[model samples]
Target: MIRRIAATLSALALTLCLGVALWLNDWIDETEIPPLVLETGVEVLDRDGALLRAYTVENGRWRLPVSYDAVDPSFIEMLVAYEDRRFWSHPGIDLRAFARAVWQRLTSGRIVSGGSTLTMQVARLLEDSGTGAWGGKIRQIRLALALERQMTKEEILTLYFHLAPYGGNIEGIRAASLTWFGVEPRRLTAAQSALLVAIPQAPNSRRPDRFAEAAEIARNRVLSRAVTFTDLTEQDVDWARNEPIPTERRDFPALAAHLSDRALADRPTQATHFLTIDVVLQARMEHLARRATTGLGPQISAAIMVMDHQTGEILASVGSPDYTDHPRTGFVDMTQAVRSPGSTLKPLIYGLAFDAGLIHPQTLVADRPISIAGYAPQNFDEVFRGEVTAAEALQASLNIPAVNLLSALGPHRMLSAMGRADMEVSLPMDEAPGLAIALGGLGTRMDDLMRLYGGLARGGIAPPMHWRAGEAPGDGQRILSPVAAWYVADILGDVTPPPNAPRIGLAFKTGTSYGHRDAWAFGFDGRHVVGIWMGRADGASVPGAFGADLSAPLLFEAFSRIGDRPTLRPGPPPGALTLLNADLPDPLRRFDPQGGSNGPPQPSITFPPEGAVLAYQPDLPVIARVAEGTPPFTWLWNGAPIAIGDRDREVILGDIGLGFGELTVIDATGQAGTRQIEIAD
Candidate 1:
């Protein structure tokens, strides 16, 4: 009877203990685990994953996310050694450490160490629970066990690396490293690693920026302990102790400021953004822009853009000289602003003419003073070259030959070509397309011109430029035939560089807008295209600021900084003809509006005699008589075509404006004559 009672009591006790243990397990399982998702700031990185800029998180904290792989091995080893020596072997709690802490407290009447494992610390950090209370400690132990079950050791350590505070409003190893050391934590010195390990214990009191001495003391303690626990030797620790701790926080990288702002504004919820810009190139370009604009004027500003024409990737873009300078209105992005293109559009005009088979490079064209419709355009020096080859006229940027070519090609056709190339040009509202468009009487942005030039560089196919990484390139539009494109590049490649500038073998053009409001230089090599602009931000004229003087030198300097010799120019295309004036076809030898016909005598404008001054009247019609050779004629007022296919010898010139005007008549046989007259009020 005694043996039976004993067995039954033992069985009851065992069942009760089993029930209690099951209840404890259930209670632990029901513990509320806070969300493990961490909120971090947005980071803008270059193509190579270099940080270009960073934005603060909510509550104005400089907390960037870090991973186990991004940290240095030394830092991890020291951190594990100093915080939880047996972190790899412990399940959640270290009973040996706990027992030692209790024994020390009983002997000394004071608590020596907390004996909390790294997992327990992570649990407390995750919940933001205080360590002074028994309830919080017990809760941490439970949560630590749960965390160890759910996450790997590396993951828990990464959480600690991210959540551990360094100083005021700064969290994570990345933030601390960038703030104090001005570099990533991927590679750190022994001192830097030790300092990072010491900061979490007393973040506020031992901040190196505020209390360097205190921080050094804490750091030395870790290093001394590291001698035993880590691979660091006494010599390494001694060397690290001699190194100076950073006393002030560093500013995060602010390269590509405008682009960063744009990226952030574009996707506010994104944690990180990757762009195609090269940080090194971007920095160099920004420096170049600042140097170019300094001492010009307080209001003067500059912009630059560099791209790979083949792939249409923007490698570097400097929007303004200084983004913080309010006097220059640096907040504006000039690359996207619509301004006059001036002679920058000349190459395109010449290219189109070549494509239309209207003129060869060696074709003779007249650049004498002439008027079209009512507009009289002149060369930059107000001089005239009576006759010049098409190549010479373009090389000198003479206005008359370009206008003549545009007159033949029609302005609307050129615009259509641009549209086909995916370039948008803005003309004045309610104005008909006219010959003045040939000499930059329209508005276009720098980016659009880069695309156009990039097309020229890529054998006439213009690829759309992009900034975002991994963006698929679109099928480019054909702006010119391969032959015509080659011709343009060949001519531009020989353009003379500015004084004192190296001959970098670049095919480039420079343009100064009317009134010197905007100066532009667009250039390309075998693989790249770069555009530069300099002027006042407010659109005010910069006196004597010519593109050749202001922007051309900067363009060359930019190429030099790009640090690659210009690639070799491509060979001529199959259909491209290389001919001299004497060896050319009759029609291709001279630019003739009458199809190279020589049958009729040259026409003359007889009614408006040379240097004749006529009275100006609003609605008066002046009769123009042509004396000589052909039955049908084309007459131009100013440089604009007024009448075509006129069978009569006399045509009425109606509403001639009050000014010096030119009357030109082209006969059916490709012979022409002109008369300069004045209509005075």
Candidate 2:
């Protein structure tokens, strides 16, 4: 009876134990894996997938995503060899390693190793674990099994590669590689690879920048073990072991900061964005811009943009000399900031005139003092060339010639052309387009200027530039005739290079805005278009900072630094004319500003009617207008010519004598009109 009773109890206990095991198995199978929220920081990469800049996550962690291919093969072998020898063959749990750990701990009276696989570590990271020993280990084991079944080995490795901590705020091999060695993981040497593989085991202890001796010790440990599993020879292992640890972390490459910020702002939720920037070239150009700004004095900054003419890819865009420069307001992106373009827009005006058959490059133009209404435009040097060919006038950037052509072309039409070419020109509120726009009275962004120049480089077809991959190239808009574009490009190419610089053989133009507030240089080779701007963020005038003097040399330097110099001159299209002044047709020789056989209309004063008593203060503003006449009108007070400004429509007659005075206006065609007004004090 006793034997039968023991048998029954044993069976019952065995049955209960089996039932509990089955229940636990079902529970483990049904347990759902916690969702891994690897909220990586925003990363900006160059065209070649090189990191340009990275923003930390809200939690201040650098969790950049990584793929197996992005890491060195040797690093992977060393990692697996040292951490989990059975990683490839095991189904997440290595029975032999666990047994060895238990035996060694029991015999030595202390724990030697945890014996956790990479998959198990990943599972643990996915969970919020407590200090409970056996229970937590069992849970991790179960989760590891589930994960192994759900994910492939490569995926698990990728997770470990990205999630492993390397030091303070740094996670993943990619981040560590960049921070510790100033390079990508794929470019790591044997020493660098071993160092990265050993860091995650004790990240704080092995931080090369913080604990150099500890880091070296850990690196040597990995290197000693690497010879057993990796293809590295004994010599390789010895050299890597002897390699000194990095003493400092490096600054992340800060190329295209403003642009990257803009990209992030546009897609705030995205973790990564790729731009069209060539990081190598971008770095070189940024260095150049910074060096140039130092000599420009305090509070002055510079911006440059490079675009491929054929593909419309913006290869480089340096928004400022230094984005962190607080005194200079370097945070402001001048490339997108609207500022007066000065004489930079002259090339487009001449191109339009050529397309309209209004004039040719060699056409004669008068640069003498003249007025339209009361507005008078002056040259930068305050000296005018009497009779210059259209090409010469444009090459010299004479304000009078540009104003005359703008008056004939009509400001509305010129602005309309710019609009069609995907460039926006900012005008004063409630103001109509005027000839003043021809000489920097309007505002435009540097990007628009690049597009305009890029259009000229692209045989007169203007297309919007592409900044990111997969962006659709816009339809090409015909901004100028092929022949006309070629003519302008040819004229600009012949412009004298800045002193000591080679004739870049590029069609380039420079401009100085009114009050010397902005300097601009836009140039194009056969395959590229480059635009540069230098000025103060507050719009403060920097006297003597003219475009040709301050910005042109930098422009040439940038072109030379651009890798693989392109052909200097572009081939002329059909119907294009390459001729000297004497080879042009008679009608094309001298542009007829009147556009009629009859002489230009006599100038007349429309405001402050003749013989009217006008109340005026010496400092008060007064406007004088003419009913009909050609542009570049000149105003004389008592037969004396005053030094007027660059305008055609209206002139600001500053401080006319308080007594009765005679006002006379003369057009470029030599027609004159006079009026009399008495000022009441």
Candidate 3:
């Protein structure tokens, strides 16, 4: 009779819970889960929906997808063992456990125990619980009925995985995996799985790290059940129980935040939208960036990007080295920093000038020192070259010539181009009055600079920069005439120094900002163009850190090691214009710096000068000159040796580097009178 009464009470409690759950379900509005907000405004993903990172939102509530592959099998085993052992046997609530629970409660003469099963737990979670005991019981019973009627055993477990709270604010396995283990649910190992399963019981109050020892106890329970019910072997349980779990992969939480701030510009939530990043290429880019940044001190940083010139897709982007694990790194993202682009902006001005029909590849310009009223434009050496074709001037990286071209174009044209390129600089329009535009006198960002050059690379059409895949791109304004674009490309291709490694064929340019505050190098082969701008985001100056010295090495190294990419025929320019080498009889090298290469003929000195010092005159430093000879050779000196084009020490006065050295001649016909010497005062 007592047992019958206990059974009756349990049945009555189950019936009450079931009715409440039905009432709540019918009363409540909806149950479908909402998505996590994209506070950063731009979403970065691999080509597929796999997430790379995200930014903070006002609510700080972001939800990632709960994939079917997400739950750890061990987690399932543990939940079944501890939450409801007879979960498969029961329709929803366990009638036997409920009866026993009622008898215990009655014997204790108070509410000492309350029986609950996974299905009832699911019900309470589906909606808010009422305050009174009767109300709570009704709610639980109603939810159990809902679960039993609406879901299969498999479906119940899946929903529970999604709705079950694991830790503070982490609603599902996917979120919990990222927060604690730094990996996706699919990536967690058995040990990690065990620890996660133990967390939901007392989430916020429990510290997985602090109670790692206690987590082991629960881990064993899951392992034992898994062995008996599943095909898992005893050895597997032993390993999980005894072997320490290797740490889960960590993420650069700070980087995500930083990328969030920058990538989340006008449209704050845009960062979470599907981005145009190619996961594979982004991986490749990250590897290359990390390798390059190795050994750089903590204060140092780097940003690199791989851009598809035609499509404007950012294939791979690494703003900082892999910091997914190091706790100390809660800082900067290299990708979106607003730093000076140094010479990376060179191509923009040059391309623009060419597009405007103001310049051509074969156009002759003087690479000589000239003083602009307020600013004196000089080459790197503060020297000058007499004249050179536009291609030669750019290839040699002559500063003066660029300033001259800028001067010729004037600042209005430059400002116009800058506007078209989307540069947000506060230029007075009067400051950049000359050819110095070729040297990137104005500051620019890595993103805009890359886009500007990409325009030139992709037939002079400005391809919009995007972080998401979309239906179709709107037309971009034509920034360059097809002929103008080809002219610059052809020039860059012809003038580029041979690649350090024959394996790499690149068409690129290098640039350095004034005072060496930034170093920039960018180039493209066929399919892709990469622009790298490196410097302290704080705008620190690193002397001698010119484009060739810093950014170029990385650019070259990447292309050299990246293996073969298919060649793209830039195709013929519009109007049937084609590339043809024009000898351009114009003078390209400067004739003077006093002792410059273009200096008129000088005298010769001799072996007497080996140790003997002649009276030194301050003005006319002793100069050795030679008569023009056959076959070219180098010359050395007592006064100052000159390279007499052929095998003689003819005074090409500026040939100072060959000072006090031997003259090597290739052709015969030696003439003693060929050499002349200007004795020291």
In terms of lDDT, which candidate is strongest?
Answer: 1
Winner by TM-score between candidate 2 and candidate 1: 2
Instruction: List all candidate RMSDs to the true structure.
Output: 11.6, 12.9, 17.3
Which stretches of model 1 miss by more than 4 angstroms?
1-20, 102-111, 564-566, 592-681
- Stretches of candidate 2 exceeding 4 Å from the true structure: 1-21, 106-109, 128-132, 579-583, 594-681
lDDT of 3 at 348: 54
How displaced is residue 97 in candidate 2, in Å?
2.6
Worst 10 residues of 1 by lDDT: 593-602
Which candidate leads in TM-score? Answer: 2
| All candidates: TM-score | 0.83, 0.84, 0.67
Clashes of each: 7, 15, 50
Candidates arranged by TM-score, highest first? 2, 1, 3
Q: What digit string (tens of lDDT, one per residue) describes model 3 on residues 117-186?
A: 8777666655645423867876677567556766688777766666666554556566667777777777
- How do the residues 17-41 of candidate 1 rate in per-residue lDDT, one tens digit apiece? 9999998788678878888888888
Candidate 2, run of 10 with poorest lDDT: 638-647
